[model samples]
Target: MDAQQVFALLCIGFVLAAFDKKKEHFPLPLLLLAAGILCSFVPFFSNIEVTRDLIFDWFLPALLFVAAYQFPYRDLKKDAGLISTLATIGLLLTFILLGISLYILLSPFLEVSLVACLLIAAMLTPTDPVSVVTILKQTGPQEAADIVEGESLLNDGTSIVLFTLMSTMYFESQQFSINSFLIDFLLVTFSGAAIGLIIAFLANKWMHLIKDNEYHIFLSLLLAYISFYIAESLQVSGILATVAAGLFLSRHFHVNGDKEVKERLDGFWGIIELLMICLVFLLIGIAGGQQPYISYLYYILAGFLLMIAARYIVLALIMYLIPFWRHRFHFQDYLILGWGGMKGTISLALLLGLNAGGKNSEVIFTLTFGIVFLSIFIQSLTMYPITRKLKAQEQKKKESS
Candidate 1:
């Protein structure tokens, strides 16, 4: 679909959502996804196709930027230690466990080598910020939500680092070297951050100079794409760049501006997010239509199992090793951590980008899409109940204390 049609559908969807009582109970991602699926069945709309470039180029940066822009930087800093551990060590643990499990269990019928399995595992490691933040908005107790958001933000960088390294190794049959991996990872991450920071600084300065809300609003949208483009040109992680730029802009803009600027920017980004959310989810469903149904079913089931089992094992191991985390961790937190790690567009993009000759490429993509769907719909819908129970238990303990 063209941009105008997409925008119009988004307006209708948002308006319907605003009026629909059922939407309030379900996660917005799930609702948008359903709309996309419904659109696919329509007589003429079945032929609608979105290219990978549109999603990667037009949608991703804006979505990531808005997410980063809205992030509470101060809260993120306060929980940096916990968030870092989850994003880094926690991610590594999950990756190794999931990769090994997939290789062992699905190797027989899947016909993929160990490296290919690892590549797929790494691709599915990142959590969807769009879904997580949507869930956070529905649930109260902002503390737990902040932790999930912070982990999701930082972990995207970590997951992408692993994905790039592993994908290179798989496709090139290159041997592992810690130094080589570190060099590439650091170059991408550091360059992304450096570029994003520079752009954010310049953008903020320009906004201050203009001292006009309309100009600031338009510039903010431009800043999102500019930071991403610059990062991509530098051969860095453009998504991370957008995130960093967003957080920096959000913090500096608040400190430098009055309430009106903040309000205008808030409304502006909200509209951007609403439009992007629909487009992204629609893109996701359309992407899924390319996969054959039969082959993907088994792999999807296997992926679902591997992802969940690996998550539980990682959470248990981490909590056991870290006494502080053990003390703080609750049953519901464990459940949410495993379930809330929904895989979205990032996974879909990587899966589609997989070389066609790669072992079981079609099967792998189908499985990846299935896992992504389950992650967003099943886990996202259930997270609220898990959080509610955990919060209630915590309250009970407080009363007893």
Candidate 2:
């Protein structure tokens, strides 16, 4: 297919997703993923694959920029401690334990190395901000949603940095040491933020100088791609850079601009966010279409259990040990937190990005796909009910008090 054809289909995908969003029964991500899966079998489009470059280079920056801009920084600041703990410590523990436990549990049967297990863990660790924002709006307390979303926003950078670290260790045959890991983690995190801040600062200045609202809106589009590229070029976490730059630029742009610029910026990014979501889910479905699900049933089931159990254990420990968390968050809210760590497009992108080491690669990749599908489909189905129960309990407590 020519470049033009691909763009045309993406346009169509956006329209389809827009229409589907109105239907309460089918959430937009699931709907598009399903559509992509069904479309995979069709004779016309089966040959064309959505390249990893297309997704990474284009789709992701747009998604990340808009999400950061829309995020309530004030709310995030208040819950910084909990979010930081979950995003850093909580994520690291789950990623390590998930890999180690899976390696132990599936030991003799699955011929995967410890390093490979760690890589798998890192890939699945980051909660999807895209999914976080979309689902949390309908359920739970504002604080709970803020913590989860903030953790997701920050933790994605952590997870990706960890993923790169693990990948390097495995590929380069380097020994993993705590001191080395700590130094590298700090380097990646700080570098990403610095890069973002600098770019966003300059971008803001450029926008203020421009009097045209249209140019300011379009400049945001460039800001996303530029920040991501510059960060990646410097060998740091592009995702984090994009997040930081977005938070700053959005605030700066809104403060300096007239009403028209703010509205235009919001509208343009809004369309891009929707389109990115649609295309990502669709690509997930298409990528997953060729897998032998029946043959890989055991891996899928086991992987799902391992991921869920790891999350449950982390939540339990965090709530039990932290007095503030224990007192502030209801047990039901804790349950929601455990189940709410849904994986999406980023997981798949990482899996595809890594060097495949023969047959075992397929197993790990398929296991990841299973986690993502279950996260979006099975877990999402129960979310509304869980939130309803939590809200009801919250209301009752208010009445009783």
Give per-residue lDDT, candidate 1, residue 150: 73
1-401, model 2: which lDDT tens digit per residue? Answer: 46764675687587776687443345677677777788778776677676666677878888888988887667666777988899899999999889898788666777778887788889888888887777765565566777777788788767877888888877777788888788878888889989988998998889779998888877888888899999889988788889888888656645564567777878888878877887777777887877777776787788888999999898889877988888987777788788777888777777777776744777777777777787788776677777777778888999999
Off by over 4 Å in 1: 3-8, 253-257, 328-331, 395-401
Model 1 C-alpha lDDT per residue in residues 1-401, reported as the tens digit of each score: 76666675677567646765654358777877767766666655665666656777888899888888888778877877877777778888888888888888787876788877788788888777777776665664566667777777767667778887787788788898889878877788778878999999998878878966899999989999999998988788888888889989877755665678878989999987977887788667765754676656776877897898887788778766778887876666666666667778777766666676875676667777788887877776776777777878989999999
The global Cα lDDT (0 to 1) of model 2 is 0.79
Candidate 1 vs. true structure, TM-score: 0.91
What is the overall TM-score of model 2 with all chains considered together? Answer: 0.92
Q: List the residue pairs that clash in candidate 1.
A: none
lDDT of 1 at 293: 62
State residue 363's C-alpha deviation in candidate 1, in Å: 1.1
